[model samples]
Each structure stands twice: as C-alpha cells, then as structure tokens.
Target chain A: MNHLASQLVLVPVILPLLGAGLCLAFGRSARAQRIISIVTLSIVVVAAGALLWRADQFGPQAVNVGGWPAELGISLVADRLSALLLVVSTVVTLSVLLYSFGQGIVEFGRDTPLSVFHPTFLVLSAGVSAAFLSADLFNLFVGFEILLAASYVLITLGGTEARVRAGTIYVIVSLISSVLFLISIAAVYAATGTVNLAALPERIAALPEPLQLVLQLMLLLTFSIKAAVFPLSAWLPDSYPTAPAPVTAVFAGLLTKVGIYAIIRVQTTVFPDQPLRTLLLCAAILTMVVGILGAVAQSDIKRLLSFTLVSHIGYMLFGIALATEAGYAGAIFYVVHHITVQTALFLVAGLIEYRTGTTQLDRLGGLARAAPVLAVLFFVPAMNLAGIPPFSGFLGKLALIQAGTESGDWLAYSGVGAGLAVSLLTLYAVAKAWNRAFWQPRDEHVDDDVPSTGALHPGQNTVTEDKVLRLPRGMALPTLALVAFSVALTVAAGPLIGVSQRAADELVERTPYIDAVLGDVP
Target chain B: MSVDLALIIAIGVLVACGTTLVLERSLTRILVGFVLLGNGVNLFFIVASGPPGAAPIVGASDERMADPLPQAMALTAIVITLGVTAFGLALAYRTWQLEGHDDVQDDVEDALVIRRAERDDTSASFDEVDESLPEEEGADLPAVDDEVTRENDEDHESPDDGDPR
Candidate 1:
C-alpha cells in the first residue's frame, strides 16, 4: 500500500494522457468523447486527492520512471505543494470540461466538428499535471510544451479572424517564452552538468555569483513572461478575451496560475535564498496596481475579469517574494482560493455571454431581476474576489497581509499596501460591472442585441425583448458546483490553511524534498 | 572547457537577425524570425554541450567524450520549434486566406480602448480634486458606451457565424 501510494503521483499525469488518446480514438463521437473525458478527469481528480492525502501524510514522495536513478531519469514527485495544486486544478478542469460539453450541445447540437475539443482539452490536463509533478527542469519544460501545444488548438478552436489574430499573438508570445526557457535550461546545464532540480541547489550554489545571477535572472524573465507579471503581461488581456467562453474561462483560471506555480517551485527549490527579492516585490506592487487599474477601466466583463486575473497574481507573488514559511503558506492557500474563485467567475461570465449574446456592461441590464440565480452566482465570486469577509478570498488575502507585515521589510510592506488598494479597486470594478449589467434598468435600445420577440422560448418573460432567458442545467450545474467548491474552501479554511501551512513548511525546509529524491546524497 | 568562439559569434548573428525580423509587422517576417530564433537557440544549446569529442557510447574511449545530454535536449527543442513554426505558418496562411494580408493588423479597438482608459484616468483624477465636475467631463463615459454598442452591433449581425472555415 505504501509502495502504491508512492507511485500514485504518476496517475495524475498518465490518466490524462491515456484519456486524451482514448478521446481521440473516439473521434467525432462527441457523446463518447464527453463520457471518456469526464470519467477520466473524475478518476484523475480522485487520483490527485489520494496523492494529496498520501503526501500530506507520508511526506514528499518520489518515483523515478522505469526504475532509472533519480538524477539520470525523469522523476515525478508528489509533495504537499504539488499535490494540493494538482487536486484543485484538476477539479477546476473537470468543471470547465463539463461546462464546455454544455457549450458544445448549445452551439453545435449533438455532433460538433469541434469534437477536437475533448482530446485537446484532455491533453491540456495531462500537460498541466505533468508540469505540477515534474521534478526536473527539462521535464517541466516538456510539461509546458505539451500543455501549450494543446492550448494553441483550444484557443484557435473556431479559427475566426479575431481568434486567429489573438491566437497568433498568444502563440508568438508563448514561443518566445519557450525559446527563452530553452536557453535558460541550456545555460543551467552548462553551468551545472544536470537539470535535475533536486541536484541543482548544491551545484548552483557552488557557481560564481555573477553566473548564478545570470541563470536566475534568465529563468525569472522566462517565467515572468509566462506568468504575465506587470510589463510582461500586456499580451494577456488582448489575447484571452477572444477565445470561446469555456476556453477563456479555463485559460484565465488555470494557465497563469501554472506559471505562478513554476515560479514558486523554482524559487523555493533552486533559489531558496532569493537574490532578486526586492525586484520581485516591486513587480508585485506594479502588477497589482496596473492590473486593477486596467480592470476598473474596462467596460467588458471578459476583459475586466482578465485584468482582475492579472492583478490577483500579485498577491501570490507577494507570498513568494517574502520567502518565509508564513508567506509560502499564505501563497499556497491563496493559490487554491484564487483558482476556484477565478474559475467560477469566468464560468459565470460565460453564462452571461450565452444568455445576453454579449458580455458588454452597457448592453446587459436588470439581469438580477431576470436571472436571479446567475446574479447570485456572479455576485458570490465577484464579492469573493473583492475579498469580502467570510469568503476564501478574504481569508487568503488576510493570510498574505499577515505574512507581509511579519516580514518587516519595506518592500513587503509596500506590497501589502498595493495589495489592499488592488482589493478595493477590484471591488469597485466588479461593483461597477454589477450595477451596470445586473442592477440598472433594462433599456429597449440595449435590448437590440437579443433576437426578435418571436424567437423567445415559451414562457420567457421578455418584457422589453419579449424573450425568456433559459439557463441550461448542464452549464449552470457545473458553475454552481464550482461556486460551492469555492465556498467550501472558505468553510474549510481552518483545515485547508493548516494543510497549506504544513505544505509551506515542507517547501521552505526543502530538505524533505531533496532527501526524498536524492536519498541523503553527500 | 575551451569556448567555441565561432559558434558563439554565429549564434549572436542569428539572434540579431531574428530579433530584427521579429520586430517587423509582416507575419511572414515574424515567422522567419521565430525560425531563426529557434535555430540560434538550438545552436547555443550545442555550444553549451561543450567542446566536440568522441561519441558518448559505451566502449568508446572516455577521453573527453561529448556530452550527449545537451544534444538530446537540443533535439527536443528543435522538434518543439518545428511544431510551433508549422502551426504559426498555418495561422499566417489562414490569415492571408481570410484578410488577404500576411501583415499583422493592429486591432482597431486596441488604441481606442487604451485612449479611453487614459482619458478616464485623467478625468477621474480631475474629479478627485474638483469633487464636483460638470457632465461635460463625462465625455469619455459615452465614448466607452459607444464602443460597447458598436461591438454589440457586430456581435448581433452574425450571432452564430464565427469562423466560416
């Protein structure tokens, strides 16, 4: 049983890969693909949960593929940190997958040529899992590549002019980042003859200061681009808003967080004593300020949510920059919180888009009266994102702020201030969206976007457009499930925070991870 | 480990050319730039593999055998780059098919959105000081609504006709 538990880490990555292949084999059978994808993802969620339990109980576990030595062969590790992320991310992906299935039914009926969506999406899940579990730099890069390739397909699903345009920019930016990451890997291997992350700290520490700085800065720059940190983040808002709603939802929620996860992994593992601490802190401040400011100025809900996504990345970076156990704990907890909240918000945005034929704030009005359920859905996540008390977002932010103040550094202190401002601005932005889109009185002019009253579904109370807005059970159920999952995170914060703090401690110590992999190598 | 000056210089030249080409507005140029960049990085990876020597196979003389790991890594990088370039060019071809231009066009609304954000920010700052601004300063407000309505109009015209391909 212990042996099996140790090997559970591979299931999360492998299950998805197998599911993707099987989904592809199902070919054009959207029903079959949906069943295969959902079942596979559900099993993956279970697998990830088991791994999280095992890691939390058994300490960090390592498995070298094909019985090869750890340093020589690829390794998959299930530490507390990776395990926690794997669980949350898979859960989110499952919800989004279900949402997309709902979308498929609505858009193309039973047989959508976009059958390609299922296989590509499963592959993306595999990639994300691979990234989280990978214990080496090269493997991590491979993980990123796999997910990115899948994302390229997902983002350009319909190949519309706008999607193609956005996809072009996204692909170019991703390719550039990939190249930079390759260069960084080569340099690291050149400096220290191995890319095994566990073996890196000693070798990297032995390198001269200037050389170490170069490698660190290079990796940081690559990840900063991937993570959309401040100045490097301009490409995000433009690119993400154009994808189909479910695609946009998942991309907005999980993709950037993967970059954030990488940052935490590299910073905690390879460069535990951060050399660019001050720089990271400054970037956090600017990212928060700039992202929220952009969010506030946006009139489109999708674009507004994108900016908020960028802004909230600052909080995670805050915990990372502090480089303390408390900070890491806060960061981990915040990551789990943000993933759920962000995914739920985007799902709600997708709902809004489906119902209204647009997500523009001006065209949508009195939705609170019309679709009370959606209003509650949007209101929950929006307020949660705004850090309203009793919500997980608030708890997460409070943890980060506590850690920031405990750091006693001026940079961290300033980051706390910026974080507070970002929270307030996020609230104002969401409130403005809510007021305009949901609370404002319906206007006949704005009703132009809807179909003529004749097309209204029977019993749809369309006072102005004379049309009823039907919320699909398929879509709404998954979204409501996610919203409940987030609320559960808040309800279970005490235990979750404990788990996060323990995970943070293990990450901070680093000894358990190294020992688990290298086995007390001198 | 003696440095390979020639390889280093070639890599530098490749990177320079790639950078310049990538900066151009033409999608084909950008594609070429990306290809060059990939090649340059691959070459750098080879350089990072260190001085050339005997094959890394067992039973070969172990005297300064060439490191095979970086070579393996570079090969993977090359495969990935090939995949990316193929996808990018396909996109470029598709763009040409649709819009009849290989040149990337700036999103028409991009500038307008940015300008509005800036205008709103300035007006917001003014309001912070004045605390009582007339409706004239609300000009940016309506402009944003106009953009939304225009976007809504476009969205309504072909509600289901995305990606005719």
Candidate 2:
C-alpha cells in the first residue's frame, strides 16, 4: 500500500505528459485528441483524490525517480497541500478544456482540427502538475519553465495583432523572472551545496543573517513578479485580458496561484523563521488596494476581472504573511475558493462575449432579461468573489481575517482592515459591472452586428443566413459545472477546511515532509 | 573555494550589457539582451561548481573532480534559453510583419488615461448616471456640461469613434 501510494505521486505529472504526446500524434483527429485529453485528465483527478486521501490518512508520500536517493535525483512529493491543490487545479483544468472545446466548435466548424490547442493545453496541465509535485528547488524551476513555455504557446495561439502584442509583454516579463530565478538557484547552490528542498533548511539556516535575508529577498522578488504582487503587477491586467477567454481563465485561476504555492513552500519549509513578515504585509495591503482600484476603473468586464484577480491575490498574501498554522490554512482554503470562483467568472465573461461579441460594459445591457441563465451564472460567482455571505468567498475571507486578527500584530490588524475594505470595494466593482452589463435596460447604441439570440446544441452548424449566434450548450454546461463546484466548496467547507488545517499544520511542523523525502536514506 | 576572477568579470560585463539592452523598446534588442543575460547566469552556475578540475566521470580523473550537477543545470538552462530565443525571434518577426516594426508600443489604456488627464476628466466608465441622462438634458443643464463635454471630448479623441468594444 505504501509503495502504491508512492507510485501514485507520479501519475498526475506523467499522465498529462503521455496524453499530450498522444494528443500530438492524433492531432489530425480532433475527436481522438479530445478523448485522450479527457480520459487522461479524469484519471489524474481520481489519482489526485487518492493521493489526497493517502496524504491525509498517512503522511507525505515521496517517489524518487529511477530509485535514486532523494538528494541525488528528482523526487516528487505529495503532501496534504500538494495533493489538495492538485485535485482542485486538475478539476478546473478539465472544466476549462471542455469550455474551450465548446468555444472552438462555435468559432470554427466542428470538423476543424484544433491540433495545437489540445497538445499545448495538455502540456500545460502536465507542467502545472509537475510543479506541484516536485520536491527540489531545481525541479521546481524546471516545472515552471515547462508550464511557461506551454503558456507562451497558448497565449499567442491565434497570432492576432492584439494577442501578439499582449504575449510579448507576458513573455518578456516571465523570461526576466526566470533569469532571476536561475540566478537565485545558482547563488543558493553556491552557498548551500545542495538544491533539494528537504536538505535546504539546515544549510540555509547556517548562512549568515545578512546572506540569508538576501537570498530570501531574491527568491521573493522573483516570485512576486510571477505572483503579480503590487508594484510588479501592472503587466497582468494589460496582458491577461487580451488572451482568448479559456486561456485567460486558466492563467488567472492557476498560474499566479502556483507562484503563491511556491512562496508558501519556500517560506515555510526552506526558511522556517519568518524574517520578512512586515514586508509581505505591506505588499499584501498595497496589492489589495491598488488592484481593486484598477478593477473599479475598468470598463471592460474581462479587464475588470483581471484586476480583481490581482486584488484577491492580496488576500492570500495576507494569510501567508501571518505565518501561523491558521494563516496557512486560511490561505490554502482561499486559494481553492479563488481558483474556482475566478475561473467561473472568466468563463461566464467568455459566454457574454460570445453572445454579444464584446465585453465592454457601457455597451452591454439587459443581459438579465435577454439571457437569464448567463445572468445567474455571472451573479453567483461575482457575489462569491465579493465575499457575499453563504458563498465560499465569504468563508475564505472570514478564515483569513480571523487568522489576521488572531496574530495580534498591528500590521496584521491593518491587513484585516484593508481586507474588509477591499471586500466592500470588490462588491462595489462587481456590482457596477452587474448593473452595467446585465440589470440596466438594453442600450440603443449597442452594436447592430450582435447576433439575435438562438440557443443551439453542440454538433449543429451555427452559421446561417440571418446570422443568429446561439449559446452553445457545450460551453454553458462546463461553466455551470464550475459554478456548481464553487458552491460545492461552500457546502463542503467543513471537511475542506479541516483538510486545509491539517495541511497547514504539517507545513508548519515541516518534519513530516522532510522525513517522507529523506527518512529512509540511512 | 577558489574563484576565477576572469569568469566573474565576464559574467558582470555580460549581465550589465544585457540589462541595458533589455531596457530598450525594440523586441530584437530585448531578445538579444535575454540571451546575454541567460548566458551570464549560466556562466555563474559554472563558477558555482567550484575551481576547475578533472571530468566528473568514472575513470576519467584521479584528482578532485568538478561537480557535475551545476553543469547539468547549466545545460538545461541553455536549452530553455534556446527555446525562448526561438520563440522571441518569431514574435519579433510577427510584430514586424503586422506593424512594420518590432518596437513594443505603449499600452493603449495608458495613452487613454493620459488623454483624459490632459482634458481634466475622470474615468469615462465611472459615472453611469450621467450617461443615462437624456442627451438634450445632459447638454442643456449647465451643471452637467462638464460631464457632457468630457464625453464628447472622449468620443472625438477615441479612435473607435466612442465605441472601442
């Protein structure tokens, strides 16, 4: 059973890669590619669930490739944090994949081959899984590179002028961060003699205080850029809104969160003593205030959501800065909640764009009357994102605010105040969007090019003489599924929070992870 | 650990030049800068591996052997840099094809903000109530002229003729 659990650690990372290979091989047949991706991801979801259960039941599970010792070769570890995030992220990825298929069939005819999309998407999934499971710093860097390479392809998939422009900024920023990360790794190895996560704590602790702070700051700087923390976040709203909706959805949901995950891992395990608490707290407050201000100023729904995405990251940063078990637990729970809600909101925005051919808020109106279903879909997640009671967002924020106030530091108290104000501001922003895009009467100046509403099934050809564009059932169902999943997170908050608390405890203790990786060596 | 002064100087020069090049608006220059920066970092990995010594393979050396790990890491970094360079060049080519040059343009929204501030206007999207008012009333009411003037000014300045959807 132990061996089996250990082997399961590799499945999430490997299966998507194999699926990507098959997807590329079967590129000419869209159906085959779709089937391969769906089946592979389904298996990954199940495997991740099993891994989570095993991790919760036992402890961290580790697998050393080629039977190499932990220090000598790559090791993949699935502790409670990793496995839980794996399950959530894979589920989100699968839903977005399905949503994109709906979009593809609608935009291009059903028979058109999406050869590049499927393969690149699967590779992206593989990279994300690899990053989550990797147990060493170098392996983590490789994981980031893999995902980033895939993202560059995905972001610029269409090669449109706007896409190419946005992709340039995204690519350049990411490359700079990667270079910085590589330099950090080289510096770390120069100082520590090892890059393995389990071995790093001891070595890093032995370094002089100034040296340790420098290394910590360097890593934090690299990750802050990736995570879209405040001063470094201007590129995100500018770039993310230009991608195709599904790409934007997944990137908004998962990519920055991966950076946050890395921050959690390194801060907790690699540097157990928190030295930069005040710095992180300031960043958290600034990110929240500045991000929401940007969100409130946006006229485009996609751009507004992107800014809000940046804002909500502050909440997670707030939790992490607290540096307590409760704080980590809240952050983990918030990560799960935010991923689902944010992705669902973006998917709904896609639907809005699909129906109206635009996301500009001023030109959009009466969606509640014209497409009541979309209104409901947008409403639920928007309210959830705003921390409305009875939703997962509120619960996650409650957990974070509770953790923050419990810390008793003035900075934390100020963070709690900023968090509360941001929640209200988020509510205002989304409410303004809701009123502009849905509740208000249809504007007479809205584009005449918008197609008349007609609901259509997946396989039907949407092209017609009158140019009626229908809401594809394929797209709506997957989005609905995601919204339902967010609600499920709220309904099942008790068990989920328990799991997160356990994960947070293990993260803070740090021994279970170190032992799982290197305990059996001698 | 013995460090090579020459290698350190080379790394410093490469990184400094790379940083300057990266700050340029031209995509081609930025790509070149990226490559130099990447190579500089890769050399740092080599320096981190310690003083030069024998090959780290069985039966290849009797003396102190060089660490193989940083070399492997450098190789991986080189491969990644190679991939990124290809992609960057392709992007630059695409930008040139599209716009007749590969220099990155200013963000459209930033330009819009500067335009708004020059006319002493707030965000166009913020005041929906003013927008909802009847056009004649918006024009006739002296109190609402500022809003109306701002809206008209935006319409004239906007490339899409007041609709950039």
Candidate 3:
C-alpha cells in the first residue's frame, strides 16, 4: 500500500501530459479532444482524491524518477498539503474546462477548431500538478515554465487585437520573473551543493546570515511578481480582463496560488530560520489595502474581480507571515476557499457576459429580472468573496483573524484590522457591481447604442451585436457545480481545518517530508 | 575551484544590457533583452558548475570531471529561452501587423486613471459623477468622457490611418 501510494505521486503530473499529446493527435475533432480532456481530468480528480486519502492515512509520499537516488534524480513528494491542494485544483480545472467547452461550443459551435485549446489546457494542468508535486527547486522552475508557456498561448488563443496587447504584457512580465527565478536558482546552487529541497536545509543553514537573507529576498522577489503581490501586481488587472472568460477564470483560480504554494513550501522548509516575518507582514498589509482600493475603482466586473483576487492574496500572505501553526492552517484553508470562490465568481461573470453583451456596470442592468438563476449564481460567490457568514470565505477569514489575534503582536493586530477593512471594501465593490449590473433598470440609451459598443475601447465587449439572452446550460451547470463545491468547503470546514492543521504541523516540524524523500537512501 | 574573470564579466555585461533593453518600449527590443537575460543566467549556471574540467563521461579522463547537473539545467534554461524567443517574436510581428508598430501601448484603464488624477477628480467611480453633482457642474463631466472616448478611438484607429513610419 505504501509503495502504491508513493507511485501514485507521478499520476497527476504524467497523465495530463499524456492526455495533451493524445489531444494534439486528435486535434481535428473537437468532440474527440473534449472527451479525451474530460476523461483525463476526471481520472486525475479521482487519483488526487485517493492520493489525499493515502497521504492523510500514511505520511508524505515520495517517488524518485528513473529509479535514481533521491538526491541525484528528481523526486515528486505528496504530503497532506500538496495532495489536498491537488484535489481542489484538479476539481477546479476540470470544472473550468467544462465551462470553457460550454463557452466554446455556444459561441463558436461544437466543430470549432480544436487544435490549440485542449492540448494547451492539458499541458497547463500538467504544469500545475508538477509544480505542486516537485521535490526540488529546479523541477519547480521547469513546472512554472511549462505552465507559463501554456498560459501565454491560452491567453492569446483568439489573437484578437486586445488579446494580443494584453498577452504581450503578460508574457513579458512572466519572462522577467522566470529570468529572476533562474538567477536565484543559480545563486542557491552556488551557495549550496545541491538544489534538492530535502538536502538544502542543512546547507542553507550553514550559509552566512547576510547571504541567506540575500538568497531569501531574491526568491521572494521572483515569487512576489508571480503571486501578484502589491507594487508588482499592476500587470494582472491590465492583462487578465482581456482574455476569454474561461481562460481568465482558470488563471485567476490556479496560477498565482501556485506561486503562493511555492512561497509556503520554501519559507517553511528551505529557509525555516530566516526572520523575514516583518517584511512579509508589510507586504500582506499593503497588498490587502491597495488591491481592494483598486478593485473599488473599477467599473468593469472582470477587472474588479482581478483586483479583488490580488487583494485576497494578502490574506494568504498574512497567514504565512504569522508563521504559526494556526497561521499556516488558516493560509491553507484560505487558499482552498479563495481558489474555489474566485474561480466561481469569474465563471459567474462569464455567464453574465454570455447572457448580456457586456460586463460594464454602466451598460448592464436588469439581470436579476431577466435571469434569476444568473442572479443567484453571481450573488452567492460575490457574498462568499466578501466573507459573508455561512460561507467558506467567512470561515477562512475567521481562521486567519483567529491566528492573528493569537499571535498578540502589534503588526498582526494591524493586519487583522486591515483584513477586516478590506473585507468590507470588497463587499462594497461587489455590491456596487451587483446594484448597477443587476438591480437597476437597463439604461435605454446604452441599450440602443449596443451596436456602437464595440467601438468603446476600454470595456470587454465580446458579444456586442447578437446578445445571447439565455445562459448556456453547459456553462451554467459547471459554474453552479463550482459554487456548490465552495459552499461544501464551509460545510466540511471541520475536517478541512484538521487536515490543514496536520499539514501545518508537518511543515513546521519538516522531518516528515525530508524523511519521506531521503529516508531509504543507502 | 578557479574562478574565470572573463566569464563573470561576460555575465555582468549581458545582464546589464538585457536590463536596459528590457526597459524600452519596443517589443522587439524587449524580446532581445529577454534572450540576453536568459543567456546571462545560463552563463551563471556554467560558473556555478565550478572550474572547467574534462567532459563528465565515465572514465573519459583521470582529472576531475565537470559537474553534469548544472549543465543539464543550463540546457533546460536554453531550451525554455528559445521557446520564449519564438513566442515573443511571433507576438511582436502580430503587433506590427495590427498596429503598424511593435511598441507596447499604455493600458487604457491606467491612462484613464491618470487623466482623472490630473484633473483632480478622485471620484471612486468614473461614470457616476453626473448623477451626484448638480446640473451645471455635471455638464462638464460628459465632455471629459467624450474626450477620453475620442482619445481611445484615435489610439486604436490613428496608426492605420496615418502610417507615420
């Protein structure tokens, strides 16, 4: 059973890649591509669930590729955290793939060219899985590059003028971050003999204090850009809103969290003794305050959601900064909650865009009356995003706040304060969007001017001419499923929190993971 | 391990030039910068591999063999950079085809924010000012909106019409 669990670590990373190749082979038939992707991801979802159960039942599971020694060859490790996140992320990706199929089928018909989207999407899933499971820094870099390369193609899939422009910024920024990551990896390798995560702790501990700090900061800089933390997050809102809704939704759901996941792994395991708490707390506070402020200013629902996505990253960073078991638990829980809720919200926004011609607040109205189900869809996630009670978002925020207050530090107290304020501001922003886009009467002037809406450059006006008044059942079902899944997070918060606590304990102790990777070495 | 001054100097020079070019507006220049930056980082990996030695083949030489790991990683980095270069060139060419230039444009939303800031209008919402303000004061707001709309229209359309280059 133990050996079987260990071998299962490779499934999440390998299956999707194999699926991608098959998808490319069957590129002519969109239906074939769809079936292959759905079957591939559904199988992954089940495997991830089994992996999580096994990880919880056993300890961390590790597999060395090519049967090489742990330190010499690449290793993939799945402990409680990676397995749990893998389950949630795979579920989210599967749903988003379904949602994209809905969008593609409805807009472009079932026979639309199946060449790039499915294969690239599968490659992205593979990349994300590899990043989560990788036991070494270099493999993590490769994982990032794979996912990013896939994202670059996905973002510019249509090659629209706006998409091209947005994709340029996205690609350039990602390239710079990748370069920085490589430089840091080089520095780490130069300082320590091995890039293996299991071996690095001892060597990194022996480095001079200042040198350790430099290495830590270099990595933090690279990850901060990827995570879309403040001062480095300007590119997110500018680029994300221009892509197709499903692409934006998946990117919002998975990509930045992968960066945060890396930060958590590195901070807790690699540089455990580094006293960079204050710097991280400051970044958290700023990311929260500034991100929400930006969200409040946006008139476009997608961009507004993008800003909130940035804002909520602050919450996870806050949990990590607290550096307590409760804090880690809170951060992990928040990551799960945010991934579901944010993706659901974006999918809802896509549904809204599909029904109406635009997502602009000024131009949108009467949605509640016109489409009650859409209203319900949008309302549930919006409230969840704002941390309303009886939702996972609220539970996750409560956990973070509880962790912060337990620390009893002034910095944490301020973080708690900023967190509460940001929550309120998030509510304000989404509520404003709701009131304008749904509750109010459709402005007659804007309704009459729908033909000219495409000429209006700033707004994401995808279907300006032929407005699809009815929501596609394919799209709505997956979105509803995601929203329901997020609600389930609240209902299952007890077991989820317990799992995260155990994961946090393992992270704090660090031996379980190190042993899982290197214990059998001769 | 003996350090190579020339290799260090080359890494520094390449990275410096890459950073400078990356800050430029032109997409082609940025793509070039990205390639240079990637090469410089790859060179750093070579340095990290330690002093040069015979190829890392088993029993190839009696002397210390070069570390094979960093070379493998450097090769990976080179492959990734090559993929990125191809994508970046394609993107730049697409931009040229569309806009008649390869320069990145300012984000329209950001430019609007700057315009609002310059006018001392720190209102949270852009389109809501008319409803909040009195008739005469509100009258001036639509003109600002029109000005922005015109600017955006010209921004998208002017390049094709004029073909300045």
Q: CAPRI band of model 1?
A: incorrect
Name the better of 1 and 3 by lDDT.
3
Calculate each model's fnat, 2 decimals: 0.40, 0.47, 0.49
The sequence of per-residue lDDT tens digits that candidate 3 reaches over residues B1-165 is 578999999999999999999999999999989888988999999999998989999997999999899999999999989998999999999999999999998777666556656777542333443333323434555554444434434375455443223
Per-candidate interface DockQ score: 0.22, 0.27, 0.26
For each candidate, what TM-score against the reference?
0.90, 0.91, 0.92
Can you list the residue pairs that collide in candidate 1? A460-A468, A462-A467
lDDT of 2 by residue, A1-522 (tens): 766756998898888899999988877887898899999999999999999999999898788888898788878899999999999999999999999988987753442237888888888998899999988988999999989999998888778777798899999999999999999999999999889999999999999999999999999998899899999998898888878889999999999999999999999989989989999999999999999988887767998999999999999999999999999999999999999999999999999988886777765777887888999999999999999989999999999999998999899999999999999999999998998889776544533222212111222223222233457898999999999999999999999999999999999999999988776632
Q: Model 3: residues >4 Å from true position, as ranges? A: A1-4, A108-113, A444-455, A458-466, B122-165
Worst 10 residues of 3 chain A by lDDT: A445-454
Q: Which of candidates 2 and 3 reaches a greater lDDT?
A: 3
Clashes of each: 2, 0, 0
Per residue, candidate 3 scores C-alpha lDDT tens digits across A215-326 of 9999999999999988898999999987888889999999999999999999988988749999999999999999999998777799899999999999999999999999
Alpha-carbon lDDT of model 2 = 0.88
Candidate 3 residue pairs in backbone clash: none
By TM-score, the best candidate is 3
**Candidate 2 residues B27-73, lDDT tens each?**
99999999999989999999999888899897977999999999999
